[model samples]
Target chain A: MRLEEKFKKLKQEKKKAFISYVPFGFPEINMTGDICLTLQEAGVDAIELGIPFSDPLADGPIIQKATNWALDKGANVDLFFEEFSKFNKKLKIPIVIMSYYNPILQFGLKNFFKQMKSLDISAIIIVDLPLEESQPYIKEARKWNIDNISFITPTTSRLRVKKIIKYARGFIYYVSVTGITGPRDLSYSQLSKHIKNIKQNTEVPICVGFGIHNSNQVYRINKFSDGVIVGSEIVRFIENNYCEKNFLNKLKTHTKNIISR
Target chain B: MKIPNDKGYYGEFGGKFIPETLSACLEELEIAYAKAKKNKNFVNDVNFYLKEYAGRPTLLYSAKNLSKVLGLNIYLKREDLLHTGAHKINNALGQVFLAKFMGKKRIIAETGAGQHGVAVATVSSLLGFKCDIYMGAEDVKRQSMNVFRMKILGANVIPVVTGAKTLKDACNEAFRDWVTNVRDSYYLLGSVVGPHPYPMMVRDFQAVIGKESRTQILKKEKKLPDYLVACVGGGSNAMGLFHFFFNDTRVKFIGVEAAGFGLNSLNSASLSIGKPGVFQGANSYILQDKYGQIKNAHSIAPGLDYPGVGPEHSFYKKIKRAQYVSVNDKQAVAGFNLLSKTEGIIPALESAHAIGYLKELAKKQKNSLVVVCLSGRGDKDLDIVRNYNGIKL
Candidate 1:
């Protein structure tokens, strides 16, 4: 099924999709499964499982720390799948493993796709893998029935937008800011205009990311896009307050508060 | 002789005492570096580049006119004469060569004033590796010559529009890129900051400055300098020069951080005003608020406007091996103008911070020999100077 159709289906059911991004094997390798379970239990609609790579260019200070921790615990492709296998029980949300191309290449493409399919990853967002450079991976992802989430930055030209929107399966990641993934002021009119442009160009669901930090930004973004992603801010929250006894509940509450009407 | 704990801590300043999330990564690097350093071949390879490519053993030139003007002898550690016109090349060469030795094929780096990007790109060009440089959009605009230089060297320069669109955003972007592409790429940090290995490795590479200066001073004056002066952005050049004299209590090391307006005003004098905290990996003195959140640091010299200083420099300041001083924009400009007219050497605005304090120090101290690190040439800063001088170039 196309990601656009999936997004529309969720909306028709009056369900808002929540995509949680946490570094793979963060805090500790043992903590990975528990964090996933907590997110799944807290009613996360979808999960973007980030395989912690040492050199993450699109992340912020919080995610950087998470990547460092994950790498320190000997997290790699082997550990990634190993961790995923621990959550063998049925998950509530669609699990999408978000990673850069280097790790996948290191693991070998043929085996990687096969593992993703077996692990039941619904989608993949390979950051830095532009459409022009992603033909082989996209083909493999499609063969495995794994949806490919394409990224479109504010600086992305109109022609590039059309190409990405035409082929994107799960959704089109609209980078609200012009730069790397972090918090900044959103140009609502520009964003809405871009959304409308994408809506006009293709049928894919548009999900905005790269700086929807506070509740106000989420509420604002929720009105315009099919779904919203809060990666760095949540990562920052975890960094600041993860060890607390009520951390999971606090996260759930924060999510609820942001999406509340 | 002992490697400062696993955290790379040097007297509480260099610890990787971050949140648990990054501890593993730091440990991985620590182990890797320990092994890498032991490999004699790796040391030789990095040393080869240091000698051949970065124009190592940079000269110790006596600032003849400045000495005459101030009535005190002043010698300059000419890091400005390095391959990329700054001391940044020394570390870039070392780090990138190490990346190649580690079998990493791709390089990702961040730049503020673009000196580091230019240096990294220049090294990557020679190493035949794919290179990506993350720079703030504002920095790209301000340092367009360097942007052009990096692009010409075949490195992809990605403009980061996040945050204030300065060094901090560039750092964030670089970290994000690293998180995504860690396996096949190495993050070439611009200074002696970041996680373990980087701070130590960069300092080791840049330490040649002090090594050369110490020898030159002994040969010329038959003694060590009474005072060593250098500007601190992330404190690389300062660290390089001061590390050799660290044990020498007689040679006073004075590091001038940019006080944008003043220390009390908005500025990047992190060492003077900042409190200790864990940021970007290492525990160091950083410009932070009462809540311990990193504060925005401002400076006219783009290179000196960092929110934090190197962990080693922070430690040195705490223990009094080095004294941290702040130089404001007006003073730096005066220093720049003075050096250009008197010495015919246009030092980088970052280096001007140290120069800015020299006149006052010369006046205060009687017959004291001062060695200031001219960390970079000012060719890239000519445009900014032209604007400030109101003269068409």
Candidate 2:
């Protein structure tokens, strides 16, 4: 299935996409497949598989800890690709790889995107590759048929929003706050105003991310945005519960609670 | 000499590879910095502070004793004599003056060896702006004196407890702060690293060292020095001295990097053995694993303990305009002791790396004049030195 079809399908069903994020190799490379399967089983529309980077400037403490823990356990791109290749045919939802630019840039963009394309990865979110430096990634991603998910923050100027939506693919990641990825008490009315402002400019579906943690926030975001991207909150939970006896069960319950009923 | 090509690329190395949240802020900074360079009052303010306050035209002392010991004509650019005990105050005063110009109330920075942190704190205090410094927790423990100095200077020193607890992590935390509070706070970046305007701006602020060195060298020796040397972490002091001589084809540049254990072992020798990659916004030679996870940089001198260097340094390396070498921790400590005993100057461990390399350079030629930038004073490093040599006194 194409990346846009997922959003179209969700829109036709009058439902919002509940995209749950899990760092691909949070505990270890092998554990990621199981974690994704569990999240899928718990009823997520898509998986935002975060690749562990040494320097995640856009991340907060929770995701930073998770990334460090993942890296300490010997997480590498080859292992991630090998693991994902095993479960590629089985994945029911789209896999959007969220990573910083360095890891993939060093991995060789051509080879990395080829593997991502073969694995049927729908999109990629390079947190550090802002629009100006994104030309190289955009060119490479287009050739490989991978959707380039761009970010639109509250701070993004109106002129930039117009420029971004012109070439925007898959969905626009509407950063809910001006800060890094972590839970924050965001004003819904203000967020709604920004979201509506962005919505008016683009036909591309938008998902609100960064600090949307609870069912209440999820429910509120679903009323407007096409999807809700739950990142640091879920990563924080796994950091606390990854070693628990019933980790999968806890994750399922936790994920189910946040998805709008 | 002309670089960054309007889009800020120093030979395919530096660019504004930042986040969207900070894009407008960076663009604003770029425009403001461009104008600030042309603004007569801004230029006067920076020059005035550099002259009247930070003690510009620091002595180009001919180190005759050290020169006789190494069998080479050695000249020392005594940046250690500057206020705040390093060349860092030059950039700090300039950046904060710009912050004052732009009406920013808060000034924030990241530090490794604490020289830059102390400099920023000093300037922030002098300028009466609210100040916060992010230093690695490990650095806070090591450079405890500098930490205290920052606090007493009326700056909030925030310890960064993430990612090897060193310079890189502190930089990450500082970027997070800037990203969050970019509107109200001015990120007074410490070195010639980071994105576009930072490397260019910091170098411009610090170019006074080279500017002064050139004039002083000619008056004393009747010719430009054959070689210029300075230690490289993020390459601020190095760039400060090197950029002015870029057009002086007769002069050669050498950047000394800290080889913590050895280049083969744990080290911070980015230009020596690092691969080209992006980290902390700029594309530079970064010490990383094959999979691109940035490796922890190790150095006894906290300042040079970074895995990445300035993009401009990488450009110089690639274009063969400059050469880079490494000195081990033991060699650096040896350099520290040799300079103290021979010249009565205790060089910072970072600067000692360059001093240590002089022994190697002395072997190549005789009677050639070489200038080494003593980038900072070594008072903050006394604890580390005592511990290294097991000296009770």
Candidate 3:
């Protein structure tokens, strides 16, 4: 199902959407499929599979280290598709591929989109691609019925928010902080004000990310926004427990703990 | 000669391709720069610093000895004589002036060869603003003298040890800092790379080199030089020298990129072999693998050890306005030695790439008037050169 349909279904069920992120080849290349399944079974509404790039300016040190390790483990665009294809058919939740534009451009946009479409990927969130430069990609992705997500930040002006939401699809990613993605304290009052302003402009579901670590943060964000995205915290957990005997169980436990709130 | 379009595109090569958090900051900078460009008082302040502090209108000298050897009337635009010993001061001074105008009390910058770092530090100290410079750990060791120069000038040099341990990694770190500190901090970018206003602004500040060279050459030779040449790292010096003569169809432009071992080997000559990709915010010619991961670039000159060129250079190359070529480490070393011995001048390894190209151009273009931008002095490179020659400096 398309992301919009899934959001509508979740709205009917009255369950807050829970999103989780993991680099495609993090911890180990072969473990990506298992990780995604664990996230799905742990009650994540969607999965954001990060395609590792050499320079990830939007990521924190933890994700940067994971990406570098993934790259060293021979992760590439093709490798991601190969691994993702393995379990995409069995996955129930929508999957969004988050990547920097360079890899997609290098992989050939048409081919990359075709591969994503074939694998039943729901959307793509290109971190570095702002609205002014996203027309071509958005137009192309639309042809494959793939949603091209747009990001709105705390620093984004109201006028820009209106302009961005006009082209926003799948969902709007609301960066909870004014910095690279990592855990930090969030002002619940300020966040509510920002999301309220954004909600006035569009009916699309708004997802809050960046600096969300524990269940309390997720619960607070879920109250103000339609969805909560947990990335670096999960990546950190995977990093800390990848070699442990009950790695999957621990990761699933942590994932369930955050969203269960 | 066409400037970037309204969206900051130079024929699809330049744009503000950063994340959402930086959008407002970049917009603020763009608005401030636009206002500053037109404000007479701001213009006067920058020009005053250019003349009195950073040594503007630097001399254009006839390299008599080198000219005799090359058989061409070779003239050097003496940016090497500018304060901070390179053309980087031109941009650094202008940006710091803008930062002060905007009420930013702290500045952050990224450096590869340390010239830009030193220049930024010099201006920050002079302007009494706190400064932090991110440099690759490898560059910190390779250009230790410059690292010391920056430290003495009152800038904190942060060594970045990630991803190839080079310029690209340093840039990544600086971007990380700017995104985190966007409210009160100014990112004083050093080259004609990065997002929109940066390529445009840095080119404008460094355009003084071309402006002075144009007038000086006209006064001295009674005509514009038949050719212009400069080294291209992120292409500040080349853009500084070439922007003025861009419309002069009679004047040929050449940019020399460092071919570390050779172009076939791991090298920094992005314009020659790299494919077009977005990196460090600009869509330019970048060395990347088929899967789009940036490749590690190598060069004896730390300043030239980058896998990408300025977006403007990519536009110029596409329009056939300039010719881009590569010179290996050996040729650059030879160029360094030749200039020191024949002219009593020690050109920086980055600048020597331009001089190295002149050897070939001189052979074919005898009797022609040619101007090369001697971008920097070689004092910081003395140790590297000495090490290359098996001598301790």
- Considering every candidate listed, which one attains the maximal DockQ? 3
Task: Tell me the whole-model lDDT of each prediction, alpha carbons only.
Answer: 0.78, 0.91, 0.93
Q: Could you tell me the TM-score of candidate 2?
A: 0.98
Model 2 residue A75 CA deviation in Å: 0.8
Calculate DockQ per candidate and list them.
0.06, 0.82, 0.89
User: Taking the tens digit of each residue's C-alpha lDDT, what string does model 2 give over B1-393?
Assistant: 478678788998988778889888888898899888899999999889899999988999999999999998999999999998999999999999999988899998999999999999999999899999999999999999999999999999999999899999999999999989988999999999998889999999999999999999999999999999999999999999998899998899999999999989999999999999999889999999999999999999999999999999999999999999999999999999999999999999999999999999988977779999999999999999999999997
Assess every candidate by TM-score.
Answer: 0.64, 0.98, 0.98
Candidate 1 lDDT tens digits, A1-261:
234455777889866566667887777777777777777666656777888654455666667667767776877888788778887465656777787655675576778889887776668887746564467778887788888888876656676666777778887787776445566788788888888888887767778887777778776777778778877776776677778989877876766665554
Please give the range of 10 consecutive residues that has the lowest summed lDDT in model 1 chain B: B17-26
Off by over 4 Å in 3: none
Quote the chain B TM-score of every prediction. 0.95, 0.99, 0.99
Order of all candidates by lDDT, from best down to worst?
3, 2, 1
Rank order by DockQ, top first? Answer: 3, 2, 1
After the best TM-score superposition of candidate 3, give how far the Cα of residue B332 lies from its true spot, in angstroms: 0.5
| Model 3 DockQ vs. reference | 0.89
lDDT string for model 2 (A55-174, tens) is: 999999888888888888887788789888888787889999989888899899999999998888969888888888989889999999899999998888889889888879999999
Q: Judge candidate 2 against the unseen true structure and give its global Cα lDDT, from 0 to 1.
A: 0.91
lDDT of 3: 0.93
